[model samples]
Target: MLTKQDIVAVVVLYNPNKKVYDNILKYKGLVNRLILVDNSLTNNKYLFKNIDFVDYIPLYNNYGIAYALNLGIKNSTEKYILTMDQDSAISANLINSYLKFLNVNDNNGIGALTCQYNTDRNPAVAKKGYVKVRQSMQSGTLFKRSTFDKIGYFDDKLFIDVVDLEFFLRMKRSELSLVRINAAVLNHHPAETKVKKILFLKLKYGQSSEVRNYYKARNLFWVAKRYNSLDMYKGLTISWLKIILLYDDKRKYLKAFNQGIKDAKHNRLGKYYSNYEGN
Candidate 1:
């Protein structure tokens, strides 16, 4: 029988709501252990008491997701570590299915396993069982402890966004595998709020939030610099250019894009942008 000692779920929470707590409860019986890293400024002691399954590690302030996840992973004592966003809810059989698949295909050099992330009108699915993708979203992904030992922890410099992509890209460069298990599914809440917040985020931070754009732009540059790969640089450049043109508000979009470029050039990252609610 697979015991809780086999797998540990490390979920990083930032001012999490009841929905997050409820989601954790749903998966409580499946994993060997549950570790919750609360990256909130205020102490949520009372809230932590209600969650019997999770071992809470409360941070006084918002330490970027990368930092929080590092803490969770370092503290965990399990063979496999599953890192996820607080907002994500997993299917009951997700963990069991992933473990079974892993056991049978031991030859597959997979560093991480990803589930289908449902967002907006489109559901992100893997083609040909598990395509060799350049990136994987932080939510709904399980990481092999050995992979971290090989690649080191996430870059703390990237505090918030694009950290997952940076980690995955590093694994890709090392020829490690990232598999997508179609049997596992995760429901994600898309940032489909009003156009005002969207426009503000684009203006203030460029295409994504300022924090996200900084990492996206800087990390892309860093990856190209370290790997000396023109293909990767070209792909990211095209993606950024597309975002710049996609916005309805040209002025705000251009301003944010310019700011992002300037920051990227200077390697200014980890600082939160104004108007961004530290997510």
Candidate 2:
């Protein structure tokens, strides 16, 4: 079975709140070393200064999620690596269960063993055994240390949104599978989302700002073009419709969405920067 020495944990931070410390405490003791990759505008080293067995890497700028995750992976040498977000936490029992499952299962073709975490968009349904999933969120997911060497690291070009899904799809392209450990629970707090009902149709919308909408649109198109998937286009179209119809700041969102499309077509990526907009 995998022990504390066999696992390294990486948590990406972005101007995290006090609750992040509480979340970090949940799994800090379960791993040999916990790495905090801060992508905040300023250094937050004081947060983990008193914590033992934890290393902090401050970027001093928002380098995006993919860059931070890759940096953490590069600095670790453990057999298994657990990736967590500032808003997610895992229990000791969940870590032990994941370790036990890894020890018993044939992990040759498994890209990652993820937890049954709930999301505002899609909540995980509990089941008796694990389920094979096409893609999964990055938080609360345990990856084999060598998985990157096999399939490659997360794409740095896409930046923030859909970084996890892009990695999962890349694993799929390499014939690797993602397994969700239904019994392994993780407390993952997604962005604030609300539901709207119109003529018997219930629509869920997230509190993603215009800047985030830009990434969502651009990355979706980029991934779709790279993978040649019509389903991705359909999904993007639905999101566009939702933003136009449901979002309070529809004009700003629409402008960002259009800019994202133009940039994607021109192959422009890796952090969105515009003279008129400040992010």
TM-scores for candidates 1 onward, in order = 0.82, 0.92
Q: Point out the worst 10-residue segment of candidate 1 by lDDT.
A: 202-211
Q: Provide the clashing-pair count of each candidate structure.
A: 1, 0
For model 2, how does the per-residue alpha-carbon lDDT over 20-118 read when each residue is reduced to its tens digit?
A: 877777765688899999999898989778888889999999888999999999999998889988878678866877887887895689888988876
Per-residue C-alpha lDDT of model 1 across residues 161-266, encoded as one tens digit per residue: 6678778878886678888777767777644332324453632222344445444655666556656757548856864775565545655544554565565566
List the global CA lDDT of all models.
Answer: 0.71, 0.83
Off by over 4 Å in 2: 120-125, 200-203, 275-279
- What RMSD value applies to candidate 1? 5.2
Winning candidate number (TM-score): 2
Query: Residue 56 in candidate 1 has what lDDT?
Result: 89
Q: List the residue pairs that clash in candidate 2.
A: none
* Candidate 1 regions with alpha-carbon error over 4 angstroms: 1-5, 124-131, 193-211, 229-235, 238-243, 272-279
